[model samples]
Target: MAAVPLQEWERGDKTNVEIIGYGWRVLEYFHAEEKRVMVRLHLPADRDKDRIQLAVMLMLRDIKHSRKWLCEFCGAPARETHTFNFFYRVLDSDLPRLVVYCHFVCDMDKRHVREGLTATHHLMNTRFDGTLGPMPPFASFGKRPSGKVYPLAGSCAGCQHEDTAVDEGVLKRCARCKMTRVCGAACQRADWGRHKVACGMIYSVTFENWG
Candidate 1:
């Protein structure tokens, strides 16, 4: 389990987190010092930006990473909150819907659960609010609210994969040009090498989005 930085926990910005393992769709950020857990979700690629942002805001209000289940109160997407009795189970239910996900954990004791779904219910009961009713054996924080986790936006157009290189964990450079592949590195490299110097200058142009 990799340790999360202080700033990331204090300030939520996954620009420095490394999510190599734990499934392609899942993400986990660990806080060793305080034993805190941050939950994140995988947003669909084809979703509209406005809808995605709305889902994210809803997740924040309910402390959920994504909108896996619909709320009983309102037709709006449901999220996990400290007020629920079976919070952990509800949280786990949200994962399969999202393609990518992850969270921070302490030990194997809490790791073991029925299909990894019950853990969310347990965490909610214990951490969100102090209600010893039907509690599971674990560490602490059955009454405290867990940290917020958000879906990471943006990807490298170069590889077409969702993985990011900002954390310095995996330095993926352009395979053809041997330069950092931020976007379309392979295509740019091929064109630059064979197209001559004059041709290369043609692509050195930039355009504004709103202008």
Candidate 2:
């Protein structure tokens, strides 16, 4: 579904905006100060609908706490909860905003640690009262690899060869994406034609200001 513009929402007519077949309903609408408009969306009980809701929430400038529990990192249902404090830079403001993560362990799993910033943890005294049991182990959210057994290396993007630590500088990451690993300059040069598009897309979205 296409995203509705702010002008359409400001029209103050519920029928002016179309969301009939989009599996979402407008529960409430309010105009706040500072030219901010609040629209409460009621999403259906579907996975895709939930994802749409999450995307909408992320675009909002000022978000308040809700009763729905979601993992800040993975967007899954939160079982064990903790609070994390981090500064998030937005387009509207020069100063970064202090944001709190409901699931602090998920934040750690993403490896978002900066050079000088250290994250302080505060455990929330909340427990899941639903029928669901303890949270399952996620592949992306787990203890850090020792690098002794796994070595924390990726396969060569060009040759598709499994990177092994034969020397200290065996595999070097691509300067742009930093995700693709190349065995040597020759492999990187060979892969440039095919890898450039994907690399640019990933790097722009992840690192650069493409918002």
Candidate 3:
């Protein structure tokens, strides 16, 4: 999804490019114009946040990048992205963290916040409602994005061991959540304290085939 934009950013007349994808968070340091593009995202009144202030934007030139976005609903290439501010913050500013995107299929609602300097729902009308409520923590996106390429196998949560040496092919999934796997009862015991918190949050997604 970001391929064309990267190409445009590198070869087109503009020195910088801007987009708004709805599902991911926003990264500050884009331009003030991009900052203003936030109002249209229709994010829930309360989005999650965190404390770490990221500095990757300042070093954009030195960083190797490979982020390409897709439409959450249609799975098509996306151009513009949406906005939402998760946990990160500065002293007194609202720095949006996640992002959502839209293609030409949607129409801009033609709205702005605070003298067109900030963004609000830029586009909303589409064949179907593409708006998302709020982004979840990066941990719960379900079966990591690379799960297909690298399906996770049972590893001892306690000692982080990976071999079974037997024919059972890894230990059974944790009984409660049916997601976590451990090498044996003892390892599960050692890791129980840490895994409990995450186990409660690991409910499967509604879509069976989703990653």
Question: Which candidate ranks first by TM-score, i.e. highest?
Answer: 3
Name model 3 segments beyond 4 Å from true.
1-46, 51-153, 165-169, 205-211
lDDT of 1 by residue, 38-155 (tens): 2333333343445444443333322221112222222222222222222232234322222112222222233332224355455645664644366444445343245643222212
Q: Which is better, 1 or 2, measured by TM-score? A: 2
Clashes of 2: 0
Worst 10 residues of 2 by lDDT: 15-24
lDDT of 2 at 65: 14
Per-candidate TM-scores read 0.21, 0.25, 0.29
Residues 41-92 of candidate 2 have per-residue lDDT tens digits of: 3223232434433433332211111112223334332222332222221112
Candidate numbers, best TM-score first, in rank order: 3, 2, 1
| Local error of candidate 1 at residue 54 (angstroms) | 5.3
* Of 1 and 3, the candidate ranking higher by TM-score: 3
- Stretches of candidate 2 off by over 4 Å are 1-153, 163-169, 204-211
